[model samples]
Target: MPFVNIKVSAPEPTKEQKKQIIAEVTDTLVRTLGKDPAAVLVMIETLEAESIGKSGLSLEDLRSKK
Candidate 1:
C-alpha cells in the first residue's frame, strides 16, 4: 500500500483539481512504481497565508514585495 501526503497553503483548491491531482499521481505511480491504485492513500492539508512563507517572508508578504 502507498500512503501519500499533500499540503497546500494557497486558497482552497477546487474539488476538480484535487481529483485530477490524485488521479494523475495514482496512475503514474501504478505504472512506474507498480503500486496498486486501490491501495493508495492521499492526504491534503490547507494552511493560512501567515503559516506559509518563502525567502524569509510569508506568501502574502512576498506578493507585496513583488
Candidate 2:
C-alpha cells in the first residue's frame, strides 16, 4: 500500500475542481508510484488562515500588520 499526504492552505473547492484535482493526482500517482489509483487515499483539511502563509508571513498577522 502507498500512502500520500498533501497539505495546502484550505480554500473552498467546487465539485468540478475537487474531481479534477483528485483524478489528476490519482493518475499521476498510479503512474509514478506504480500504485492503483483506487488504493490511494486523499484527505483534504481546511485550516485556519492563521496557519497559512504567503510572502513569508502568516495570513493572520500579515493582514493586521499591513
Candidate 3:
C-alpha cells in the first residue's frame, strides 16, 4: 500500500479540487510506481493559517499583509 499525505494551509481545497488531487496523485503513483489504484491512499490535511509560521510570521499575518 502506498500512503500519501498532503498538507496545505487553510482555507482548504474545494471538493472538486480535492477529488482532482486524489485522482492525479493516484494516477501518478500507478504510472510511476506500478502501484494498484485501490491500494494507494491519499490524505489531505489543512492546517489553520494561524498555526503555521514562516519567516518569523504566522501565515495568517502574512496573508493579511497582502
Ranking by TM-score: 3, 1, 2
Runs in model 2 with CA error above 4 Å? 53-57, 63-66
Return the lDDT, model 2, position 38: 77
**Model 2 C-alpha lDDT versus the unseen true structure:** 0.74
Per-residue alpha-carbon lDDT of candidate 2 for residues 1-66, written as tens digits (9 for 90 to 100): 556565655465767876777778888889998998779877555567789888998887777787
Q: What local lDDT score does residue 25 receive in model 1, on the 0 to 100 scale?
A: 78
Q: Candidate 2 at 37: error in angstroms?
A: 1.3
Please give the RMSD to the true structure for each candidate, in Å: 1.3, 3.0, 0.8
* Model 3: pairs clashing at backbone N, Cα or C within 3 Å: none
Query: Which portions of model 3 show Cα errors greater than 4 Å?
Result: none
**Candidate 3 lDDT tens digits, 1-66:** 999999999998999999999999999999999999999999999999999999999999999999
For candidate 2, the per-residue lDDT at 60 reads 75
Candidate 1 colliding pairs: none
Each candidate's number of clashing pairs is 0, 0, 0
Candidate 1 segments exceeding 4 Å error: none
Q: Which ten residues in a row have the lowest lDDT in candidate 1?
A: 40-49
What is candidate 1's lDDT per residue for 6-58, written digit by digit as tens?
88977978999899888987898899999989998887777878888888889
